[model samples]
Target: MIGFKLLHEKNHSSATHKGTGAWFGSKPINVDIGQNPVFLLRAPDGSVGAAISSNDSANAYKQALITLVKNTLDRFSRGGFSAASLEAAMLGGAENARWKWDRMLEIVRNDFTNIKKFDEGGLYYRIIHFDPKSGLAAVSRKKANPDDWNPASAKLSIESGTKGFSEGHAGGVVANATRFFREKTTFTALREVVIPAHLAETPDAPFLFWSAACSAGAEAYSYAMYIHRLLTRAKATCPFKVFATDINQKLVEGAKTGVYKANKNDIGEYRAYFRRYGELDGDTVRFGKEIRQFISFNTFDLKQRPRKKGFRMVVCANVFQYYDDAARSHFLENFMSAVTRPGYIFVGPMRDPIIHALGLKKLTKYKMFMVE
Candidate 1:
């Protein structure tokens, strides 16, 4: 866990903005992984134990499960037996049987019985790994890939292991997401903005984009507005698609509705988002069909299986700082895999190091990157 912190903080160019005023539990609502991703570990009485991973996803349920299993096994083995020995004995065979690991995963799977599915509009949480050999479990707030899951249950026992986006930290990144496009400096904007413009200009090309963790569709709509502007100026008739996804069903629906209840600070930006795409009726802002037509909103979990089609651009901004390095790598791999060779990925400014580490070339001084 300590080592991963070093890795996550590796390319963080800015000082870790020392947060003040009761930082703990101060997470803002409607932000990814800020409050909703919950874990319900089943207790012996057939009841469930639930907790939210408000600070970091990695430390939430993964660590809790490890501790729960370890304590349970320690009590079981107090007659004097190693955790591994107890696990092996409970499985009625050697470690090769994989019974010990399977049981632990089963406990986790059972807890999800009440949770909803992506298709059924279920809750989204990622079970990164359920390793019996290492006695470690990793669950976080991303979508899960069904193909990667192993249904078999395991005997509970102690195991050792090491383990986003809202408000102060998230606010900074969200500001960056909107700010990146507003830069008027030609030197910076020309290089950064031209790429998207160019992509939309390709004759008859279907300009497809995916914005992960798109809260209430603001950022995704921003991209649509940009594409609309570029294509309109170029007189291009290229078909385009913007797939905006979030784990929350309510947020997805709200994004689809394209209605935003704007605060005082957001009035200007909300008005901008309404330009050519939305309308402002006093304090209420509603998006028009013109821009909304280009975008499709879905309840998606990035940790689950990815989309089958490739995209020209992928924007996962203002949300990367919440996870550890491993989850960060998962996000990059998913993004890179989902796009074509000559594609681009736009993340928050803080993720520059992780992007560089992945061998992507930086486009702007801020957060955009291109596959080299």
Candidate 2:
């Protein structure tokens, strides 16, 4: 109570809202509201911090939910936290908004089903003290806390509202996207896994990465942006290129144009990268020469072997789940032969079991499996 700051609900009629000052610091903060909810978040590293939400509005829960999710994702990318590595604890929904809150919780659960810990359902007035930098928090009931607050400002809605959180978005923010909507991916593994692994073992020249199932080129472009950010931040312009291939020739042709439709969530999750590497024209996202130079799109079936060898990384996040074990093994064998030793192979969860079943060992320090 002494150090924790209070946050207010947004008022649709007014353009102003409180709590920006409170959210600026690393100290614990509390939200003052009636029957809405709060979300506390933590990065998997145990130092990313926490959150809680409370607002006043009879029908604004859905609006608030989308806003919070988008903002949380923006912060996550800036902090270098992956969706798989992000954790969340939700609190503060009362019986008054059970039905609405239940739907919101479903979205959160789908995104973070494997959370560090989950706690919810506090009906009465309560206070939460949360640290965002270290993810430390304490929750307690208050004897005389005020829960009545009116909407004091305007409601903010980004393009797409709740539509961005589709099943394809995958809330994991950490999952690998392969142009497949159901599997959302992010700036994952690149900073914490791919770049580090390359620097550690194979700092070879002309570092090559493979996007085995590039779809419409979203995955390839994402990889290109990720690689550029890492290399740029390091101040090392090492020669590197991404070889993107998909069986679909039409998709490959479309990829050469380097444009895609980004929903509100895509824009949110990829806000930082898009700003630096691409252009946003309303809902359309287009990448220019800077990012395009690092990647080449082509048509190649996973069942066949690539003539080129010594690729430093391979990301085939799709097509595996649809294949039989034999087909999976064949594709794996072909791609594995193409990668360099001490390199990496990133697959999706659907393909994870086949990988383990084939006895392909995963590196202890990274999400990718070794090339050799």
Candidate 3:
């Protein structure tokens, strides 16, 4: 590993890279970030994997970084050449005016030694070194086998047993809007598919919706906004509850506050989203009383079964890809069992294949699923 000294200055800009060739214990890969660094490690034999990010709020970046690595390796087998080489190639003749690459790497190295715990999808990262300040985080197998990180010889969760909320930060409201929950499309789907499906089965019961692993309540709030719109448009008086749960208590609290400190871009074109469901009060955006009242935030673990079930629709997005096949099945089973018969599960685009593999049917019209 390269070594350096830390500079006191801070660079507000974000830098990201994707490629291959950086190896951490025989795993070939490429990914580098400045400002907010993310490191994902997988055992050579492929029995274990670890994902570390600078902040709990960098959820999208961490997920994207890991997904890119997995997809790259899966496609080319070797991924794309060495990450170091890729960095040089990208710079070409460019100058590092604002960002200090050496300073970033140095901070990452020094701060990584401080991490003591890790959490993902409610599982442990074995707790290695995680410096939230320097954005340098690393997690290794708690018990390493002489050869592969074979699960037979080692369990991944034997560290300090401290839970981490790093996985809770997905993105802001606009980020959620343009990417996952498009207001127009999502509303159409809810009205045309999810609502009617639930109505048919439980005509007299109040509709129930769950946002599993909901980070910072953005997705849940967005859903509330649209669910409000859908009901208003349809002239339906059915009562509904948007249950938003996350393993990260901090994020759940933030979600419960119904405040999002989104960026200028996040609050710009998507003004209506904030205006209708939430309000921009100075730097922080607060969800209106109407939408906030409908959501109940809980620091719930996904690994455990819910005390209650029978949700009309459940949304668990951007989380499935992190788990191994068996773990994925476990979570899928839990989710499917939680919903009403003929219920729907809304997952991200990356998780579509896993849903199919688990033998669940997809609502092709909206990229959601119907658990059979």
> What do the candidate models score in CA lDDT, each in turn?
0.46, 0.58, 0.50
Candidate 1 lDDT over 1-372, as tens digits, reads 000011122232331112110111111111112212222222222121222222212213345555554554444445444333322111111121122223334444442333321111122322221223332223233232222121111111111000022221222323123331332232243235644555544667787778777767776776777777766776777787889987667667867888776666667654565655678788777878888899999987666568655677787754443444455566777888887666777654424355667888776554466664
Q: Which digits, one per residue and each the tens of the lDDT, describe model 2 over residues 211-314?
A: 88777788788777777778877766468888998766777898999888888887877777777888888878878888899999888877577898878788
Of candidates 3 and 1, the better by lDDT: 3
**RMSD to the native, candidate 3?**
14.3
Return model 2's CA RMSD, one decimal. 15.9
Each candidate structure's TM-score, on Cα atoms with residue i matched to residue i, is 0.49, 0.50, 0.54
| Candidate 3: clashing residue pairs, number | 3
lDDT for 237 (candidate 1):
72
TM-score of 1: 0.49
Tens-digit lDDT track of model 3 for 1-372: 211122222311121222222223232222222112334433223332333333212134334434444553343335433322211101100011011212223333332343222222222112233222233333232222212221111221212111222422122112122222532445567879888776676657888889888867777887887787777776677888899997778778877887777777767756787877767776577877888888899988777878769788888875543333455556777888898878887654434355667788877778677875
Off-target runs (Cα >4 Å) in candidate 1 are: 1-202, 269-275, 350-357
